[model samples]
Target: MARIKPQALLIQSKKKKGSTRVSLATIITCNILVILVLLSLYATYNHFYKRPTSQLGEELMNTENTKDGGAVKKFDLPGYAIIETSKGSITVELHKDSSPEFVDKFLDLCQKGYFKGMLFHRVIKHFFIQGGDPHYLRAAEGWTLQGKSNGQLSTSLNSPKHEAFMLGTSKTKPNAKGFEIFITTAPIPELNDKLNVFGQVIKGEEIVQEIEEVDTDEHYRPKSPVEIVNITLKHEP
Candidate 1:
C-alpha cells in the first residue's frame, strides 16, 4: 500500500547479504571439522587395527648391512643374529640346542617388529643392558605374546641347566627369562659356570661396553636412554 524509501531498501538488502555470507562461512567451517574427524578416525584404525602380515613370508633381510651383519653365520641353529641400535648394535649367537626353546622364542620376537621400538631398559654400567621386558615397549600391555612367557615380563626361563654368568644374565633364581639379556662390562668370576650361557657377542663388544659404562641409578637403569632400533636374524642357507 505504501512505497518504501530507496535508501532504506538498500540498507536492508546489504544486511540480508551480510547474513547470507555468515551462514555460508558457518557451513564451510562445520564441513572442515567433519573432514578432520574422519581423517583422525582413519589414522587410528590404520595404526592400531591393521597388522602388516606380508613381511612374515619374505625371508629375513640384513637391514644393518655392516660387520655386525657380516660376522653373522648360519649355524646348525639360527646363527649370525644382528641387533642394530640407534646408539649401536649387538650381534648374538643364538643357542639352538642348549637353550632351544628360549632361544627360538627370542628369535621369534625378533622376527616380528617387537624389538624395533624397544630400548635397552636397564643398564648397570658393569652389570648388563637389561632389555626384553615387555614393559619397555612403546605400548606394551594390550600386546599379545611378546616373547615373554606368561603375559607380564618374565625375568627367567625354564632352562634346566646353568652356564657361564659372564656371558649374560639368566636370573637362575626360579622364573626370570622373559627377554632380559645382560652384557658383562666387568668380568664376574663367580657367574662363569653357574648360569645358563645362551649367546655371546661375537662382535660389537664396544657397543656393549658403551651400554655397560653408562651411569645408573639405584634401579640400575642408565641415566640416558639407549634404544635397540632393529634386529635381523640370518639363517644358514
Candidate 2:
C-alpha cells in the first residue's frame, strides 16, 4: 500500500502461500494423529475388555490342553516328604491332582519303610542320583526284586520334573524305575517338554552332591552307601 516495490510484493505473496501450505499440512498431520489414537483405543478394547477367560487361559497355561488338560487341577500341591540322606535332608511336595496314582504308589513305599538302608544305586555326576531300587537294600542276604509283583513301577511317559525334590522316572524301558529318584544338577534342555518334572529339592542339595562324589565302580553304585535313614511324609496338605 505504501508504494511497495514489485519484487517485495512478489516475495510477500510467496510467503502467504507458504504459510497456507504449512497450515494445511499441520491440519492433516493432526487428523492422522487423532486417527492413530482412536485405532489404538479400539485395538486395546478388543484385546482386553472384550476377550474371555478361555482365551486368556490359553496364554497362561503351559500345555495346549484345556479343561482336564493334564494340568495339575488342584492349583497347588502338598509338600509332604523328607528324604534325609547321609549328606543332608531334601524336602518334596507331591501332586495328587497331577499324578495321584504315582504319588500314592511312592507314598505307599515310603510308609512301608522300603527306602531304609537302600543305597543310592546309580549316580551320574552333575546329572542325577538314582536309587529306590530294592536291589540296594540290605535285605538279610538275598537280591531284592523290583516290580509290581514285589514293588511298584512307574509307567508314566514323563516323570514329574522338579529341581527341588527327587522323583522316579523311566528311560524308554518299561518298569525300569523303582525307588529311583534322580536329581537334576544341570538344566537338561533336551528333557524339557518331553519330561514331566514333578519335584524339587528344597534342602539337602549338598547331600545329592555328596552322594554323587562317592567313588563308583561301573554301575554308578557308590562304593560307599548313601543311606536314607527314613523318608517321612510331613504336612500332607
Candidate 3:
C-alpha cells in the first residue's frame, strides 16, 4: 500500500476501536435478554405445573389429622380402632386425655376379642346403635346385661360431646357382669357429659349411618343381625 497520512491512520484506528466496543455491548445486551427470558419461563412453569412444597406438606398433614363438623373431633390419640361389622368398618379415635382409664379398658377389651361376633342388638333410628353386650353373644356365659343409665357425668374439658358418631360407654346396672357400648347417629345433647364419650367415629360415618337406618323390631333390635366381625387397632406411625 502507498504511504498513508498519520492523521488518517489515527482516525481509522479510533473508528475501529469504537466499532469493537459497540459490538461487545450488543453481544452483552443479547445475552442479558436471553437470560431474562429463561428465568421468566422457569417461573411460569413452576406456577402452573408444580405445587409448592409448603402447600403439599399442609395437605398431607390435614389428611393425617382432621376434624369433622358432625363427626369425629380432631384428636392425637396414641392409637385408633377399626370396628369391622357385617355392614362395613368404622374407624374411631379414642379420647385418651379425657377418659384415660375408660380408653385403656376399652382397648383391653378389644385386645381380648371381647367384642367379636357380638351383634348390634339395639338400633334406634336417627338416635343411636348399641352393641358390645356379651349376653347377646353368649347368653349361657351368665352375663347380666342391662340398659345404660346417666348416673355418671364428666366435667373435663376434653370430654367429648354426645354429637353424631360419638362412641360412649353404655352404663350398666350395679353388679353387671359385662359392659356395653353405643354410637350416636345424631346429636343427643341430653346424653352429653352424662355418658362417657370415649371415642369418635372418624372415617366411618357412612357405615354408621347404614347401620342406623337398618330395619329394626319393636324392641329396637335389628331385624337382620349386624355382627361385629372384628376389631383391629392401629398404632401411631
Candidate 4:
C-alpha cells in the first residue's frame, strides 16, 4: 500500500462516520413513517367499522337516526304498511310478535280505511309527529276523515326502542283513547316503557323528517296539514 497521510486518514474516517450517521437517520425516519401510517389506518378502521352506536352526538342518530351506510338488513316482520301521505310515503314494519293485539287492531283499521285522510295534527321538530286521531279534521275538511273510536286501546311496551322513525301509540295519559299515534323523530328515552312502539319506518324516513320539520302551532300542531292519504297493508312472512 502507498504510504497514507495521517490527515487523509482522518478525513476518510470522518467521511465514513458521516455516511453511517446518514444511514442511521434514514432508517429512523423510515421507521417513524411506517408507524404513523399504521396508526392512521387503524384510526380510520375504528371510525368506520368499530364506532359505537349508543351515544348521541352531532350525528342525528343520538336522537334522530339515519340509515347506516352499510348494507340494509332485511327484516322479516309479520306485517308492513305503506302510509301514503301528501308529502311522500312511509313504509312501516309492524312487530306483531311484540304487540300482537295492537298490530291486529291497527291492521284491521287499515283494512277498513280508518287512517285515510287523517291529518298529522301534531308535529314537534326533533321530537315526533302525531296523527291517527280518528277525529282530527280541522283545516283539511275534504282531505280529512273522521275517525271513529278505536274502541278499547291496547298495546305493549315489549317492542323495540322508541328510536327515530318508530311508530308508537299515544303516551299513557288519563283516559287516553290510544288511537292517537306518533312517530318518533329521535331516540325518546322519556317515552320508553311509558308507551307502545308497535312498528318502525323501514322506508321513507326522509318523509318523516320532512313532516317533523313542518311549521307547527303553539300546540305543536302542524300549521299546514300533512295528511295520511291512505295506508296499504302488507302481510309478509
Write the number of the candidate with greater lDDT, choosing between 1 and 2.
Answer: 2
Model 2 has an lDDT value of 0.60
Error of 2 at 72 (Å): 14
How far in Å is the alpha carbon of 99 misplaced in model 1? Answer: 1.9
- Give me the runs in candidate 3 sitting further than 4 Å from their true place: 1-78, 134-160
In the range 1-237, model 3's lDDT, one tens digit per residue, is: 899999999999999988756577889999999999999999999976698888876665455434465454433435788999999999998877788878878888888999999988888765678897756433312211222233222233342387778898744342355767888876665565346788899998999999989998766778999999999988641
**Worst-scoring 10-residue span by lDDT in model 4:** 143-152
Residue lDDT tens for model 2, 1-237: 579999999999999988756477889999999999999999999988787888776655434444675654323323577887777787766655566666766777888887888767766564556666655233211211222124323333353353323554433333544445556554443344323455666666677677768898765567887877788887651
Residue range 1-237, candidate 4, lDDT tens digits: 899999999999998888655577889999999999999999999887776665323343223323687544333333899999999999999987788767877887788888888888877666677788646423222211211122211133343386678997753442443376778777665566455788999899999999988887666678888999999887651
- Score every model by TM-score: 0.49, 0.50, 0.56, 0.55
Highest TM-score against the true fold, candidate? 3
Return the candidate ranking by TM-score, descending: 3, 4, 2, 1
lDDT of 4 at 154: 19
Please write out the lDDT profile of model 1 over residues 153-237, one tens digit for every residue. 2223333222112334343432443555555554433343433456666778788777767777765556788788888887631
The lDDT-based order of candidates, best leading, equals 3, 4, 2, 1
- Model 2 vs. true fold: TM: 0.50
Candidate whose lDDT is highest: 3
